[model samples]
Target chain A: MTPLAAPKALDSFFLEARCKILDLAAILDRINRGQGAGAVDNDPRLDKIRKALEVLHDQSGGRAERIQQIFSLDYDPGWDKPKPRY
Target chain B: MYYIDPHIHMISRVTDDYHRMAYAGCVAITEPAFWAGFDRGSVDGFRDYFRHLTEVEPKRAAQFNIRHYSWLCINAKEAENVELSRGVIQMIPEFLNKPNVLGIGEIGLNKNTKNEATVFQEHVDLAMKYHELILIHTPHLEDKYKGTRMIIDMLKQDRRLKPERVLIDHVEEHTVRHALDNGFWCAMTLYPTTKCTPQRAVDIIEMVGTDCIMANSAGDWGKSDPLAVPEMIQEMKRRGHADSVIRKVVYDNPLAFFRQCARWQEWPAETEVEKAKRKPAKAHA
Candidate 1:
């Protein structure tokens, strides 16, 4: 389905979006400011977060759903089968 | 514009939150037993928690004219302790007949472990044996999609559990269609962080038509808002959605889901005098 028009959508949600973006920036800054840069350098979750950030710049819609998928587990076809936790 | 928060943990919230919710036009709420912020060591802990849900919280909500209902379970986080989970599950039936008890839920997976799955099936077995409705909590963030997929699979395996009578909660844009397309009812939780915001929840509603789906605050002992559903109402209003459409997601849909429970009562059951007083008004209109 098509998204609501930008002006109408922005009128209601622009501030919320701005605040969230600021929060994300501050979070990244905090991570950068932390002493242990190497700790997160190879962290897969951080990699995923970076990939999700790249998703935000796409012109086409569905970014939200795509980013959610980026954070979500890939669909495991055999997920119902019980597996041991490491 | 009155609405029902189909899933919130009222036991974790202050009485003032209930008052604020009432003022914001929340007419009713359903609280599912969940992680108490820390795991309890014994089934007795859960037993006492159940009493608080079925007894204490309902009384608290009544003061503000908001109807309170609850579900019972040892949450998925605690379900890893299979022995304790079983003990809690066995004791759950004692509360099933209580006036405000809804069904077995917020019962799914946290880590989607083997032990968690075992506990989940046992809870499902208990629910099916009692013919009670089910409410499921899909795991959060990274584990959500897989956990939700597994939850739906497990439920489908049980021929006795009807899809429509179950609700898979905390579904986001990715998982919403899975729950709905599988014939189960689903709820999107509106959270200030880490879940759908009011704007995103409205976006989901825009993407997926309002049918067999609803939204809730899922307010609990976290950095969450009890008025999140009201904020969703505001968001929908700003987008120029019809009030009827908003009402369906927030009001009628939840009532329809809860009405399936045999124990669910008609709230504010009108007195005969009040019924008579209302009939004349209806006739004039």
Candidate 2:
């Protein structure tokens, strides 16, 4: 069984989110390149975004499942159930 | 959607981030003194950092129309050097009266070490002596629960320190109750990884109502987002929370907390609010 297959709705949502992240990266790249020759190679803000993109780019094999597991919230349906007599 | 980031490390953030935060309705922010990604050599280093927090950063934030406030302290990570910590603590009072200065904070246990606890109590003593508000930074992951308890125990031991005046930040499911039950304010930090995510923060807020609770980005040199509070607002919206409820968690609550600071002044004056309301609408040509 493939645990990576999300429901159709969530898959669509993740796709749109991925596109927006890439769009942001492109805009940042454009701004960085627009600086021409004098731009300092090390900017904290750009560095952070690059690190975040690297995390995104590294989502291959079982890494995607692991990411989902790390972030998943647990909801107990029977949280309010009456306790059994001991 | 105007909100205040109750705790952020803007010293590590860029000016462009400030512009974006201001545009996104951040009218104010409070930066707590935390580790600068490394250990410094002397008390003079902390003095300079405090000056930047109270002087330079305020001016930079003001350029974007954001009111910047700061808390002064030798963070727990640096508190390991008890000698340097004591020196920095002795010098903090010089900046206590700075208009932008809030109080002594981002002070708490890093590894729950004995030296860290001694320095933590000393900083608390300084805060009590000066009547300054306190902001706490609890340990991360495995240490969080135990460290939060130790910090709380230390705080409880000080009879003069009022619980309400202290904010224990970076609270999670296992620790939020301890802060609130003890009557201290709590903050959930929204980070991309390692700490509470926006959804988890919202869940915690749902489990525990908005009283004495708030959220922050904790945006710093590490991986974080300055716009994380807005992302939490979005999460609240998706979960059917009201605008007023969201505003309470993001805006009103932080304002309420900051008002306790000896130096905090009211922002967005009534006259300014009235002026904005009274302005006539422009017609298209």
Best by lDDT: 1
lDDT of 2 at B172: 84
Error at B253, model 1, angstroms: 0.3
Top-scoring candidate (DockQ): 1
CAPRI-style grade of the A/B interface in model 2:
incorrect
Chain B TM-score, structure 2: 0.95
Clashing pairs in 2: none
TM-score of chain B of each: 0.94, 0.95
Second chain TM-score for model 1: 0.94
lDDT of 2 by residue, B1-285 (tens): 788998899999999999999988898999999999899999999889998999999999999989999998999998889999999999999998898888988999887777887888888888988899999999886567768887887787677878999999999877888899999999999987579889778868877898999999999999899999999989887766777788899988988988998788777565777456545668799
lDDT of 1 by residue, B1-285 (tens): 688999888888888999899999899999998998898999888889999998898899999999989999999999878899989999999898898988999899998788888888888888888889999999988889888999888877677778999999999989999999999999999987678888889889888889999999989889899999999999888788887789899998999999999987777665798456534454564
Candidate lDDT scores, in order, read 0.88, 0.83
Off by over 4 Å in 2: A1-86, B270-285
Tens-place lDDT digits, model 1, residues A1-86:
34568887778678988998999999989998999977998898899889999999988988988988998877666754542211
